[model samples]
Target: MTEQKRPPRAIGASGLSCFPIGLGCASLSGSYGPSDDDNALRVLHEARARGVTMFDTSDKYGNGHNEELLARAFGNARNSVLIASKFGNMAGKDGKVADNNPETIKAFCEASLERLKSDCIDLYYIHRIDPAVAIEDTIGAMSRLVEQGKVRALGICEVNPTTLRRAHKVHPIAAIQSEYSILYRAEAEDVLQTTRELGVAFVAYAPLGRGLLTGAVQPGSLGDKDERLRHPRFSAENLPKNLELAQAVQQVATERGCTAGQVSLAWLLAQGEDIIPIPGTKTLSRLVENIEAASIILSDAEIGFIASSIPPDAAAGLRYRAEHMKNMYL
Candidate 1:
């Protein structure tokens, strides 16, 4: 097992501590493109060897393939890594996200535990808000899982202040997972103030802007199967403009002698200690690059410079399509 070289950062008041940077694991399930199972397992083991102690997954990722992948990769090493999985968003046969109901929350939690081959989940997140069900009802059922010892900590993803306040009243929220990157910031930055006030750790998913900030993906270069192709920022018209923002990140990376992805991750790290970034990769080299980003120190001026280069709302497209965006930040 890889030993932790630095002190762990705590998440909210749940007493859960992990390396500030984590492996998001979405790519392992082929969210980006096709993935080889053996190679994905190798990447997971390599992440452990390199001190990435937190692994984030969701039931909706490849319809539980990602969770099962985590189970197979970790094996006996499960205890050494923090397993964070989510529920609430169900994918239908039509490939559309269904409503989040209490029944689904309980049933999904049970199914997730079975797939993970673990008795308890370290961190369980409600992947997205279900407008059909009250936040209180959903969180109330989640609190029961905590009481039953099935889940150690509770978290909610992509929720606004009102929902956070309501959910916290039912159970202490350990963290808030959202698409927070320098590339997409308005809503998440506003949510950060509330999470910080409530002492909830902000888990920044896609902290690398779904690979655009890494200066790797270019307009018209993504594979057809790549999920990013469905995102607005990656659209043909917006992609050219988004690449300009990526160029700004790349320029800084060149000046600092680091990868553009590292510069983006470093910028997120500089936001606050309470913020933790989970940048995903299906390869070991990119995993190590993301893990090493924690050491890239940025001064206040550099942070401001990067911000100016890619101002808030500068990215031309929405983070998700209209149908998908409706479920986020509720």
Candidate 2:
């Protein structure tokens, strides 16, 4: 397969430039649906073949299975890839999420390094901000990892401007990861403004609206085994309304002769060069399609039309469940 190479984008000013689109590895853990190790490894290797150097994973994903999969896929080619992993979000015996304390930073870093089979991580993010612990203390401990050369740069996910400022003050944040896409933007855009102000790069996860904007998922099509079924946006009542937004995306894709997913990603690429999106996939074809999105340049008018098509409130339901939503943008 011929892979298209696009211009690189920076991760803050940390001096790391990767392909415009990074590969999200959450699906490898079957979070979206069941996927085998073979296909997961294939997707990672294929991503590398296509010049996709950035691979985003977290220790919590598949309970460390995702990181191990990445290690297997990039064994000898580790130096050629940029691995971004996260800490925080500890799983209790009952599978409940817990707060991240400053004392555990070293242990988390060591565990992640061992799981990834890498001496250092390119970008390490705090998966979610812990409300109980001061952001300064968590960031202070993370800075120590950078000082020890265990992590090249630091990042945070689902953070608000206030939290971002507090964390950055403790240590310069190289990037901020958040759920950003046409279907969902109000909160992510708010966070984007702060990151741009601080010259921190923004990494957009779920850039395809969690597969809703891909023009493939229909109302109630997500199986019971899929994790998205728990999401309000994919509920029966909300699915129809959310799929309408996909229709608008499809219209633009038809006009541009591209897939709806590509149109969605293209619209994001037009947002800014500093914004890098990691659209995940369990299939090589979908991975290629997402990478090819980098080449679909949208005109100014088209961009405006796309933006107008999916307003911030166009989609129905919250991005996550009530309990999980509390941890975002804090």
Candidate 3:
């Protein structure tokens, strides 16, 4: 079979560039559920075959298993694709702690490179901010990676506008990865403005709302082992309320003759050229569904409806539990 061609697009604030839509590999290694190596590799290969040239993964995901899976899947294509990996969330001395110390940052980058089987990472992100360490100190360490040719660019995940600016002051932040979807418009309305003002690209993770907006996840649809089951938005008490919000999205999507997922992603793409959504899935059908969203455009009226339909805090429950929520927006 002939290989599928990748789409031409720029990535990062520097326009140091890559594919517009990246494949978020978190699911391949089973953050959501169990996945075999063979199945995971097939998904990666299929994504590449479909022209996905940007792959995003993190060390904490599957406890480094995800990176190893990517290395094995993209052995030869490793250089062809822009590999974006993250660090700073690995277990620390306390066993289940997060650390972003300069020493830890450097060590983590080295380990990620070894696992990815690459000489240099296309884009490296700090998975989560460690409150104990100053943002500048963390970013300063990351900047050194760029100078050492270990990382091509630097990014941060789940950071606030102030943190973004602080990090940018230390080094040019190429991108910011955060939870953004039709159901989660709080960031788009405000955080997006900050990223735009600073010329930093926003990488939207969970752009499908952990399958909520995709019309695939109904209350009790997720397996008990799934981590999302514990998420406030997906908990038993909030699931019905959240589903109601998704149903409203479905109505709008029906009017537009597109899947709810497509409407959600298209709305994000329309938010800004600097915005990129990395919605992950293990199934080929779902992967294709997500990629098509890039082409789904919304008229001004349609965009307004979507925006108003799901207000920033429209969904029931907090995005994450209190413990995890404490780690975000830092």
As a TM-score, model 2 comes out at 0.97
Estimate, for each residue in 1-330, the C-alpha lDDT of model 1 and write its tens digit. Answer: 112244677889999989989999988888999998999999999999988899999998888999999999887988999999999677656565645677767789999999999988999999878787888988888998999999999998998988999999989999999999999999999898899889999999999899989988887789988988889998889988988878878888888788899889888988988989999988788888889887778777778999998888898899999978888889
Model 1, runs deviating above 4 Å: 1-6, 92-98
Q: Highest TM-score, which number? A: 2
Better of 1 and 2 by TM-score: 2
User: Candidate 3 versus the native: TM-score?
Assistant: 0.95
Look at candidate 3 and give me any clashing residue pairs: none
Ranking by lDDT: 2, 1, 3
The global C-alpha lDDT for each of the candidates, from Candidate 1 onward, is 0.88, 0.89, 0.83
Show pairs that collide, candidate 1: none
Q: Model 1: how large is the Cα RMSD against the reference?
A: 2.8
RMSD to the true structure for each prediction, in A, is 2.8, 2.1, 3.1
lDDT of model number 2: 0.89
Supply the global lDDT for candidate 1: 0.88
